[model samples]
Target chain A: MSLELAVLDWFFEPLQFAFMQRSLAVAIMVGIICSVVGSYLMVQRLALLGDAISHSVLPGLAIAFLLGVNIFVGAFIAGVISTVIIGWIHTRSPIKEDAAMGIVFSAFFALGITLITTIQKDNKIDLNHFLFGNILGVTVGDVRDTAIIAALVLMAVFLLYKELLFYSFDPLGAQAGGLPTGLLNAGLMVLIALTVVASMKVVGVILVLSLLIAPGATAYLLVPRLHQVMLLGAAIGVLSSVSGMYLSYYVNLPSGPAIVMVVSALFALSFLFSPRHGVLVGPRRGRPWQKLRTLLPSKGS
Target chain B: MATSPKIIVDHLSVNYRDVQALRNVNLTVRPGKMVGIFGPNGAGKSTLIKAMLGLMPVVTGRVTYGDDTLAHQLDRVAYVPQRSQIDWTFPATVWDVVMMGRVKKTGWFNRFSASSRQLATAALERVGMLEFRDRPIGALSGGQQQRVFLARALAQEAEIFCFDEPFVGVDQKTETVLFNIFRELAQAGKIVMVINHDLGESITNFDQLILLNKELIAAGPRDWVLTRDNMTRAYGGHVGFFGHVA
Candidate 1:
C-alpha cells in the first residue's frame, strides 16, 4: 500500500510547479503535431527534408530575437526560404534534391550557429538551450503558442489528408489527374515548417529529427494505412513525451534528451518486436542464421 | 455522361535542358479509338503525352480537347504514370489508392459520398481486384499493382484516358485485362491513349499508332504506321521485316 502511494506521489509531484505544468502542456502539443505531420515525411521518403527545415529555423529564430519579432514567425519564414532555395537549386541545375538539401541545410545551420553564438555573448540567451531544447523553461505563453501551432497544423493535415496521400504516393499521377500538385507541395512545406517551429522548444534542432521520424516510422511497421500510422504515431508520441517528462523529474536527466531517448527506445522496441515487420520475430527471422551458415564451406570442401 | 472530345495537338515541342526531347510533334486523336504512341528509347513518347496534358512545359504549341485547352479541362481526363514512378512502399491499402480517384470528383474539403464509394468498388471489381482492396499496395505483384492503378483510373469516370507504359513488367493476364478495358472505354467513345515501347504481339491491339523518334514519323492506321520506311525512320535502320512490314 505504501509502495503504491509512493508511485502515485512520484507521478503527481511534478504537477505542483507551474513551470512543469507549462512544459508538460507544450511537450504534449508538440508530441501530437510532430508525429502527425511527420507521417507524411516518412511515407514520402523525405526524412532528410525534416532535418533540413529544423536546422534552417535556427537562423530565423536568432534573427527574430534580434528584430523583436515572434521567433516562430521568423523560424517559419527561414524554413520556407530554405525549402524554396533547395527547390530552385535542384530544378535549375543538375544537382540532385539530396545534395541541394545537404548544401542548403549545412550553410543555414552554420550561419545560425554563428549568429546565436554572437548574440549569446551579449544577451542572456543560452546557446545550449536552443541546440538542445530547454523544455523545462517553457512559459505559459510558449505553451499557448505551441497549442495554436498544433491546432493549425493538425487542422490543415486533417482537411488535406486525402490530397496529401495522393500527392505523396504518386506525384506525377496526381498532377496528371488535375490535382494542383504545386500548391499541394507548397502547402505541405508550410505544414512541415509549422511543425518544426512548434517542436523546437521541446526537442531542439539537432534532436528534432528523431521526434519527427521515429514515431511515424515505428507506427509504419505496425499499421497498414496512412491514417492509421498517423493515429498510432500520435499516440506513441504523446505517451513518450509525458513519460519522458516524469522520468526526467524522477531521475534528474535533461528533459529534452530524456524524451528523445524514450522515443528512440520505443522505436527500438517496435523495430525488434512488431508482428509483421519486426527484425527479431518477423517472417524471415531465423533465415538470416541459415543464410549465414550457407556462406561457409562444408567439411568436405 | 459527357461526350468525349476529339484531341488535337498543334505543333507541339518540348525541351529538356539544352536538348530537344520532342520537336514539331502533331497528332489528332478522335473518340472511340485506342491510340498507341510507340517509339525507341529516348524517343519522347512519354514527353508527348506529358506535354499534351500540360504536365511538362511546352516549347511551341498547344493541345486542345474540342473547344477547351486540355489543361483547362483536366478534370475530364484520367492519367496513369509509369509504374516505376510510384512509391509502392507508401503506407496505403488498395482501397485507399482507389479512393484517390474520387478525390477530384468529391471536390476539395468535401468527404467522399456513398456513391463515390460504390464507384470505387465497381472499379475494383472491374479490374478483378476486389478481394485485394484491403491489402497494402506494396505487397502486391507487379501485375496486381498495375491493375490497381487501372482501377483508380476507371473510378475517375473521365472522358479521356492516358496510360504510360502499362505493360512494362506485368503478366499476360494483366495485359489482357487492361486491353479489354481499354477496348471497352474506346467503344464507349472515350479517347484512349497508351504509351508503348514494345514491338511485340501486343502492337496489333491498338487501332491507331503514333510512331515517333523525337518527331512524328507516322501517325495513322496501324498498317500505314508500321510500314518498312516508317519503322526504319523511327527505329534507325535496324529493321527485320515482320508480318505487316510494308
Candidate 2:
C-alpha cells in the first residue's frame, strides 16, 4: 500500500466501530467544557476545588445508581453540595479553605468507595470504570448527553462572558459595582458543577483535574488575556483528547490515562517553550534559542 | 450633576467576626469636598468605608444617600479597594480592567455600548494609561496598576467616589495624579472620599478630615479635626500630626 493510503486506512479503521465514534464525540465535548470552565478555576487558584468536586461526585453517583436516577444530576448536586460544605467549614471555623476542601473531598470519596464496593456485589459495575474511564464503552446516549452539556456550558460562558470576567477578576469590585455578585458566584458554581459532571466519563473523577487544569494552565503561559487563554486552552484540550483517543486505539493503552499523558506532555512543552515566559527559550521576542546564547562565545568578550 | 448630596452614616456599627471593627460611628461625607479618612493601624478606616458602602453587614445604623439607602443605589458609587485586596496576576489586560467599570452600566447579557467604550477610553487617557491598554495587568508596576484602577473608577462616572489606600504603594507622580483628579471630581459637585493613613504633608490635600479610632474621633475641616485632644484620643498618645496642628 501507498504511505498515504496506509495512513488513511489506520485512521478509518477506528471509525468502523460505533463505540469509537461515540467515545470520540464525547471526548471532544468533554475537552471543550473542561477547559472553558477550568479556566475559571485555574485563574481563581481553585484547581484543588476541581479535584474536590470531582471526587465528591462519586457518592452521588452511587446513590443515584441505587435510586435509579440520572447520575449526571446527582453528580452535579453532590459537587455543588461539596463546594457549599467546604465554604461552610472554612467560614464557620478557623480551619482554612484548603484544609476544608481536603477533609470534605476525602470523606466523600471514601464514602463513595464504600458505597460503590457494596453495590458492586449485586451489580456488574466496576469501580475501575469510574476511577479510570472506559471511554470505548460509551453509548450513543453518552454522546448526546455530553453534547447537550457542552452546548449549555459554552452558551452560558458566552452570554455571561463580561460578567464572569469581571467577577472572576475582581469579586469585591464586581460586588461594589452592582453586579449581583452572589448570583454570579452561584452561576459560576453551577457552570463548574456541570462541567465536572460532563467530564466524569472521559477522564474519570481521579484524572479529571488534569483535563480541567493542564490545558488552561498551558494556554495561560501562551496568552495574555482570559478569553484568549480559554480559547487556546479549548483548542489544546480538543486536540489532545482526540489525539489521545487515536493513540489509544493504535497503542492499546487505556483511553483516560492516554488523554491525560498527552495533555500533560503538551503542558510540559509549553512550560519550557512559551514565547513570553519560557525557561529554555527565555522569550520569543529575542530568539528561539536565546538562552543558548550564554554557552556561545560573546563577541564583546 | 447640579448638587451632590451628603452620605449620612448614622450611628453605624460593624463587626469583624467577633471583634467590633467600628462602633456607633456617625459622620456625614459632603459633596464638592475632598474628604480624607485617617486613622492608625487597625483603626477601622477601611471598615468605616466598607460599612458605609454596605459591603459589610451593619449592626446598629443605616447609611442613607439622599432619600434611599446607599446599598440600594450602588450604581452611583465608584469604589477602588486597597491595593492588597486585589489579585493583579489574574489574566486581564489594562483595557479589560478598565472596561469592568462599564459592566454595571451596560447591564447584564448585553454588549458594551459605544458610549461605554468612549468612557473607558477617556478614562484610560485621563490616567495616562491609554498606551498600555493591551498590556497584561500582572505585568505592570504598582503605580501603573493603581493608575489602571483609577482609570476604572473614572470610567464609572459615578456620583460618589470612594478610594481605600490609593496612595499606599503609588509613586509621587501617581499620588499627584490621584489627588488632582480627586479635587477635580469634588469641584464638579461630586463626593470624593479617600481612606489614607498618611500623617505626612499630603494631609493638607483633603478639604475635610475624618479622624477615626473604632469610632468617629472628629470630623470637619482639616484644622478642626486635627486638634491635640482629638489626636491623643484617636492615636493613644505620643503621636504627632503633620506639623499643621498640635
Candidate 3:
C-alpha cells in the first residue's frame, strides 16, 4: 500500500467501527474540557485533586459494580462526596492544603483497595477500564454523558472565572468582599468531581493526571496571559489527543499512555524552546553569540 | 458614606478547643476614624478580626455593623488579613486579586464586569500599584503584595475596613503608604481599623486605639487609651518587643 493510502486507511478504519467512532468523539470533547478546566486546576495549585479524586472513587466503583449499577454513576457520586469532604476538612482543620489533601486521599484510597479486594472477590468486573481506559469500546451513552458534563463544567468555569481566580489567590479578600467564598469553593469542588468522572473514561485514572495537568502547565510556560493560557491549553490538548489516537492506532498501543506521552513531548519541547520562560532562553535577552560578543567587547577589552 | 459607627463588637469571645484566644472584647469604631489594634504575640488581635468577619466558629459574642449584624451585612464590612497568613504561590495577578473585591457587588452567575475592572484599577492606583496590576501577586515584593491586599479592600468599597496587620513584614515606605491610603479612606467616611504591632507608630499615626490582651484593655481616643498606664495594663509586664511598656 502507498503511504498516503495507509494514512487514509488508518483514519477511515476507526470510522468503520461504532465503538471507535464514539470513542473518538468522546475523547475529543473530553480533551477540550480537561484541558480547559485542567489549566485552571494546575494554575490554582489543585493539580493533585484529580488524582486524589480518581483514587477515592475506587470504592464507590467497586460497590456499584458489586451491586450491578453503572460504575460511572457510582464514581460520580463518590467524586462529589469526597471532594466536599476534603474541602471542608481542609478549611476547618489546622492542617494546610497539601497535608490535608494527603490525609484524605490516602485514607480513601486504602479504603477503596480494601473494598475492591474483599467485596469484589468474584472479580467479574474489569477495573482496568477505570485505570487505563479502553477507548476502543466507548459506548454512545458514555459519549452523551461526557458531553453534557463537560459542557456544564465549561459553563460553570467561564461564568465564575473572575471569582475563581480571585478566591484562589485571595480567599480572605473574597470573603470580606462578600463574594460567597464558601459557595464558590463548593462549586469548584463539584466541577472537579465532574471533570474527574468525565476524563476517567478517556485517559483512565492512572494517566488522567496528564490530561488534567500537562497541557495546561505547558501552555502556561508558553503564554503570559490567563485567557491565552486557556486557549493554548485547549489547542494543545486536542492536538495531543488526535495525534496520540493516530499513533496508537498505527502502532497498536494503549490510547491513554500514548496521549500522555505526546503531551509530555510537547511540554518537553516548550520547556526547551518557549520564548517567554523556556530553559534555553535563560536570563539573556539576545542570541548566545551576540551575548558572547558583547561580553568580549567585539575587538577591544 | 455616613458619619456613624459602622462596626460594633459587643463582648466578643473566641475559644480554640481549650485555649481562649479572645475574652470578652468590646469595641466600637466610627466612620472616618483610624482605629489601631495593638497587642503582643498571642494577644487575639487576629482572632478578634476573624470572629468579626465570621471566619471563626467558636466565637460567643455578637459583631454588628452599623444597625445590622455582621452576618446580615457582610458586604458592608471588609477585611485585609495578615500578609503572612496566605500562600502567595497560587497563580493570580494583582488585578485578579483586586477584582475579587467586586465579587459581592456583582453577586453570583456573572463575570467581573467592566465596572469591576474600573474599580480594581482605581483601587490599584490609590495604592500606587496601577503599573503592577498585571503582575502575578506572588511575584511582587512583600510591600507590593501588602499593597495588593490594600487595593483589594479598597475595591470592595465597604463602609467599614478591617486590616489585620497589613504593616507586618513591610518596608517603612510601604507602611507609610498604607496608612496614607487608610487616611484617604477614613476621610471619605470609611471606618478603618488596622491591627498593629508598632505601638509608637500607632500612637503617632492613628486617631483612636483599641489596646487588647485577650480582652478589651482600653478603647477610646489615642491620647486617652494610649497612656503608659493603659500600655502596662494591655502588655501585663515589660512589653519589650515593640516598646509598648518598659
Candidate 4:
C-alpha cells in the first residue's frame, strides 16, 4: 500500500470509534479556549493563578458529586471562590498572592482528596481519572459542554478584544482612561474559571495549567502582539491536541499526558529556535565563547 | 486660555495602609498653564493624581472639573503613569500602545475607527515616534518609551493631561521634547499637570507649582511656591534646589 493510503487508514480508523471522536472534540476545544484565555494570564504574569484555580476546582467537583449537581457548575463556583479568597488574603495582609495561592489551593485540594477517597467506595467514579484524565471516557455531554464553553469564551474574547488588551497591558492607564476596570477584571476571572472547568476532563486539575500556559507562552516567543500571540497559540494548541491524540491511538499511551508532552515539546522547540528570543540563534546572543566566559565570571576579572 | 475652566480640588485627603499619603489639600489648577506638582520623594504626588482620577479611594473631600466631580469626567482626561508602573516587555508595538489611548473613545465591542487611527498616527508623528511604530515596546530606549506614552496621552485628545514622573530615567532630548509639548499644550489652553521631582533648571518651565510633602505646603505661581520658607518646609531644609533655579 502507498504511504499516503497507510496514513489515511491510520487516521480514519480512529474516527470509527464514537469515544475517540468525542475525546478528540473535547481535546481540541480545550486547546483553543485554554490558549486564548491563557494569553491574558501570561501577559499579566498570573500563570500560577491558573494552577491555583484548576486545583481549587476539586472541592467543588466533590461537592457536586455528593449533591448530584452538575460538576462543571460546582467546579466553576469553587474556582471563583478560590480566586476571591486569594485576592482577599493578599489585599488584607502582608502576604503576597503567590503565597496565598499556595495556602488556599493546597487546603482545597486536600479536602477534595478526602471527600473523593471516601465517596468512591460506594460510587463507580475513579480518582485517577480526575487526577490525570480519561479522555477516552468523555461522553457526548462533555463534548457539548466544552463546545459551549469554547464558543462563549471565544466570542467574549472577540467582542472585548480591545478593552481586554488595554487592561491586561496596563491596568492603571486603562482604568484612568475610564474603562470600568473593575468590571473588566471580574469578567476576566469568570472567563478563566469557565475555561478551567471545561478543560477538566481533557487534562484534569493538576495538569490543566500546562494546557493553559504552554501554548500561549510558546506563541509569545514568536509573535509581537497580544492578538497575534493568542491566534498563533490557539493554532499551536489544536495542532498539539490532534497530534497527541493520534500518537496515543497508534502507540497506546495515555491520552492526556501524551497531549501535554507534545505541547511541552513544542514549547521547548520554540524556546530554542524561535527567531526573536531563542537561545542558540537569537540575534541578541553574542558569540558563544564570550557568553560562556561571562557566565563563568573569570576568577580575578 | 481664559475659556478653559479651572480644576477645583476641594479639601482632598488620601490614606494608604493606615498611613496618610495626602491630607486636606485644597488647590485650583487653571488652564493655559504648565503646572508641576513638585515634591521630594514619597510626598504623595502620585497619590494626589490617583485620587483625582478616582483610581484610589479618598478619605475626604472632592475634585471637580467644571461642574461635576473630576472622576465622573475621566473620559476627558489622559493619564500617563510612571515608567516603573508599566510592564515594558508586554507584547505590543508602539502603534498598539498609542492606539490604547483611543480605546475608551472608540467604545466597547468595536474596532478602531479611521479617525481614531488618524489621531494615533498624528500623535505618534507629533512625538516623533512614527518611525518606530512597528517595533515592540520592549525594544525601545527609556526616552523613546516615555515619548511613546506621551504620544498615547496626546492621542487621547483629552482636556486635562496628568503625567507621573515623566522625567525619570529619560534622556535630555526627551526632556526638551516634553517641555516643548507642555508649552504647546498650555498655549492651546489645556491643563497639563506633571509630577516632577527635579529642582533643576527644568523647574523654570512650569507656570505654576504645587509643592507637596504629605500636605500642601504651597500652591501658586513658580516664584511664590518655590520660596525658601516653603522649600524648607517641604524638603526639610537641606535642599540644594536654589542653585540651579537661581
lDDT of each: 0.91, 0.90, 0.79, 0.92
Tell me the tens digit of each residue's lDDT in model 1 across B74-186.
88989998999888888999999999999889888899999999999999999999999999998999999999999999999999999999999999999999999999999
Every prediction: chain A TM-score:
0.94, 0.94, 0.87, 0.95
As for candidate 4, its clashing pairs are none
DockQ of candidates 1 onward, in order?
Answer: 0.86, 0.82, 0.44, 0.88
Cα error of candidate 3 at position B121, Å: 3.0
User: Residue B60 lDDT in model 4?
Assistant: 98
Better of 1 and 3 by lDDT: 1
Residue B86 accuracy (lDDT) in model 3: 79
Docking quality level of the chain pair in candidate 4: high
The alpha-carbon interface RMSD of model 3 comes to 2.3
Q: For candidate 2, what is the lDDT? A: 0.90
Better of 1 and 2 by lDDT: 1
RMSD (Cα, Å) for all candidates, in order, is 2.1, 2.8, 4.6, 2.0
Candidate 3 structure quality by residue, lDDT tens digits, A1-301: 9999988987798778777778788878878888888876776678888778877777777778778898778887887777777777876777777776777778877876787777646775466777787777777888888888988988888888877776776677677667777888778777877887888777787788898898888888877556667788988988898778878887988988898999999999887667766666535557756544555645653
TM for candidate 2 is 0.96
In model 4, the runs with Cα more than 4 Å from the true position are: A286-301, B244-246
Tens-place lDDT per residue, model 4, A192-256, is 99999998888788888888999999999999999999999999999888988999999999888
The residue pairs in collision within model 1 are none
Query: Can you give the TM-score per candidate against the true fold?
Result: 0.96, 0.96, 0.88, 0.96
* TM-score between model 4 and native: 0.96
Better of 1 and 2 by DockQ: 1
The clash numbers for all candidates, in the given order, read: 0, 0, 0, 0
